[model samples]
Target: MSATGAAPRRFRHGLVVGKFYPPHAGHHALVEAAAARCAAVTVVVAPSRRESIPLDLRLAWLREVHAGTPWVRFVGRHDDHPVDYADPAVWDLHCAVFADALGGESVDAVFSSEAYGGELARRFGAVAVDVDPQRRAVPVSGTAVRADPAAHWRWLSAPVRAWLVRRVVVVGAESTGTTTMARALAERFRTAWVPEYGRELTARKLATLRRSRPDATVFDVTWDRDDFVEVVREQQAAEDAAARVSGPLLCCDTDARATALWEERYLGSSSAEVRAAARRPALYLLTDHEGVPFADDGLRDGEHLRAWMTGRFRVELAASGVPVVELRGTHEERLATAAAAVEDLLAAGWAFTEPLLPAH
Candidate 1:
């Protein structure tokens, strides 16, 4: 098929400016639209110190989202001006900063979704190109995402979504349905989940032991402090990697905090490294092992250690200062209870997670 339409309005350069506090799908669409019309485009991420999300993270997210679009480049700097979006003086200062930021580039067009596009364009001696002013294609914004990230989760890119995602760590003693619950919750929410990394490492050690002494089982090998440290490191890395692909909420079978408990159980004490690696989870779903039948996979100690381990987990969690909810019932019932708690956390805007800075 031959081309029938007129060429897109070509420009030497185009500019898109914003804090991009948390870039959404709409911002991406606008950047794409600008790139389609211009030879080159630069996205300005002007963030202030007052924002919760830092400038570097926002810049990295923009780069990730627009990685394939080579013509689209990002230039970020701190916006030191006061928070006065409606004031003309503020706009003038932004224009000066934007112009200074675009050193030698000839910006002939400015793109935006807000009404300020025209004024921004006039300041740069460029034509204003408004894309999705009504936001019909992507009916979402940074404000909406910040207000309720879980509600507008679909609109966020992977990296940005990961930043806002809260992990609901399913942690407890052995023989519980932590893995099963994590998988089910991930499937239910259509997101990613982190499996217990310590299990895999322990399995590897057991495999080596069997090869060396064919009669040995997983439970025969005793782990040292370094082993526990490695487990904590691997577990935290897995959770982080999973969160990048997870939507708004990450379902973690176990977290570093659990690794700390396991270390205390096996090694008689927890390592400082393991405890430090433990991140504060949005919610902890403690699966009670009472009704659940204890099944040994040759790795876990028998039901005799369940009460002791569960008690230690409770004590450790209390000291670590993470929210906990003790779940009791069948697998399905536990899932329902966990799902409700997660919903409540999201509804409350994740008040449990501490902020980067304390409020006055």
Candidate 2:
């Protein structure tokens, strides 16, 4: 309300334009400000074709982050036009792209944090609303994020963080310390770890069978191709969920590739659908079954097949072309080895292709 007790003015529609290279808190702030002052807001996510991140992915991330704001609509436009702040022709070309994305609707206000916000607003015949022009609010930029995403991880939303998090999968035969290693690594890093979905499914299957057969054991728990596919899908979904809340590195007991191998072991072969679901993680820690003692935990029946499974994992992992580090010896030693590998992966850093630059 105003000083005179009048309600605050609100525009019919607001417009926000940005590359949104990877939407950060600052971008969210700008959009939020627009939403607060407008009946409806349209966030135009304009990125060049040469940008590393897909335009669709940018739209999805922004839309998810602002899902609660039903009035805020996110639209994408591929603007390959050369960026030249000094050239009116370039401005016209870019505005044309933005206009087309909005279906030629009139913009009531142009919200931005850039120096050219006023000019852009003038082109649209809308009011110029500067939002944190000095970056005092969020204190971050896409350039800084792209340079070191780990350092700017907190500024990113869950979906963007999930995409940037380095995933390290710990895979091995039954009772070979895969879960232990994964949990320990997560603890060491003070991050999140994904448990084996297949194990949980196994327990569920056994419990369900016992209700009908009274004497169902782990051996009675049978698996079909659909089961493996479910495991693959659930495992990935869990990993993605964990990544959102995890630190720079995420630990996983297993992944879809491991699920594919499990499918082969049970069904005589892995199906193409299961195989296609495999996502390459940043690192794979294969726990050797040689020194580990197998314990029949009422859910495992692969003691005799441990060595064979280990061999198969090695062969498949080698063929998959993902970097694999074998963890052997005592639990302490294995944890240390896995920790070092994770540190190396973190040190290697994320490599994002540079976005197109404006003309000098």
**Which parts of model 1 are misplaced by more than 4 Å?**
1-7, 80-88, 104-106, 187-190, 329-333, 350-360
**Deviation from native of the Cα of residue 89 in model 1, angstroms:** 3.1
The TM-score measured for candidate 2 stands at 0.93
Worst 10 residues of 1 by lDDT: 351-360
lDDT of 2 by residue, 283-335 (tens): 99999998898888899888999999999999999998899999989999999
Whole-model alpha-carbon lDDT for candidate 2: 0.90
Model 2 Cα RMSD, Å? Answer: 3.0
Off by over 4 Å in 2: 1-9, 212-216
Best of the candidates, TM-score: 2
- Taking all chains together, the TM-score of candidate 1 against the true structure is 0.85
Clashing pairs in 2: none
Tens digit of per-residue lDDT, candidate 1, span 15-99:
9998775788998898988888778999888766667778888888888888888989999877767545567787777677777
Predicted structure 2: clash tally = 0
